[model samples]
Target chain A: GAGVSQSPRYKVAKRGQDVALRCDPISGHVSLFWYQQALGQGPEFLTYFQNEAQLDKSGLPSDRFFAERPEGSVSTLKIQRTQQEDSAVYLCASSQLVEGGEPQHFGDGTRLSIL
Target chain B: AQSVTQLDSQVPVFEEAPVELRCNYSSSVSVYLFWYVQYPNQGLQLLLKYLSGSTLVKGINGFEAEFNKSQTSFHLRKPSVHISDTAEYFCAVSLDYKLSFGAGTTVTVRA
Candidate 1:
């Protein structure tokens, strides 16, 4: 695809249910980032990947929040136990060059609704 | 670590009127500032950025921002705004790699 693409534009899960959100970054993008955006709030960084290596996971909110990029093309963000507070829009962004100073192109995002 | 603050939670303005969105950041090291606009049901789009060189940076859609190092602020402005400019604006600062963002401000441009 020409731009970053995300799967399951909308996802709904019961409390305590596990859910996985997927992101397909632009082809040949070297840097990928995942973020969580709550109601009326800006997107918060969750994790970052440089190629196949997860360079930064410090932004992950908790142990339940896990992300991986096996082939360095697609990424997944898994939440072990869903909670009502976990409801938010999950955003995926990919940058063509290095992480620093390069503007990231974002996807439409997956709107996760935890019931 | 870097943190951002968007002072105005919401701003309502008339069409063709000028507006300003304020953002302030706190960082120990040098900062990279950015402004992103998020339309409804869409992801954020980069409005402008300040990495190095002149503090005044211009971006897409006639939007511009000034990076005030001493004040630790990067406020976005436009001479005149249209109804299409209504959206959520975010201010972010990157110290290393991870970008820390503000709470966001909702801008409504009434016709």
Candidate 2:
């Protein structure tokens, strides 16, 4: 892909329903990241993957949020039993090199609305 | 731990005027500073970053930022502005690999 790509640009889920968002990173990107952005706030880190290895998950807000980058290319962010507070934009970013100093390209993001 | 604070929630400037967005960060260890811009309905794009070599870092769209370790600030500035420069700007700090972001500042460049 020319840039980071995310699927289902918008989503509306009923409370208690599960939602899954996908991210397709640039080819050969070594690092992938997931973030959550509230209506009027900046993006907050959720998780990170260096290739196929999950290096950090400390930013995941709760047990309901889970992310996986299987096979090291495509990543998925799944939220279980969505709540009203879960409504926000889910963003994906990819970096060519290591984290420091390297620019991370971001996807437009998936806007999730828990109805 | 690393955290960023963007001082202004909103800034209004006319086209061709100079603009500045204030940012400050706190970290226990060495950190990387970055400014990112988000256009309407678009994802964030890196404006500039301060790593090590220099205190002043220039970025695309005529934006620049200076890293001040003593003050723990990395403020974005532009000598002149255009209407297209209206966007939300975020300040972020990275320690090791994890990044922490500020609340963000929205800049509206009026015509």
lDDT of 2: 0.92
Error of 1 at A50 (Å): 0.6
Q: Clashing residue pairs in candidate 1, if any?
A: none
- Across A28-96, the per-residue lDDT of candidate 2 in tens digits comes to 999999999999999999999999888999989999999998799999999999999999999999998
- Give the top-scoring candidate (lDDT): 1
Q: By DockQ thresholds, what CAPRI class is model 2?
A: medium
Fnat for each predicted structure, in order? 0.68, 0.68
Give the C-alpha miss distance for residue B60 in model 2, angstroms: 0.3
Off by over 4 Å in 1: none
Relative to the true structure, candidate 1 has a C-alpha RMSD (angstroms) of: 1.0
Q: Considering chain A alone, report the TM-score of candidate 1 relative to the true chain A.
A: 0.98
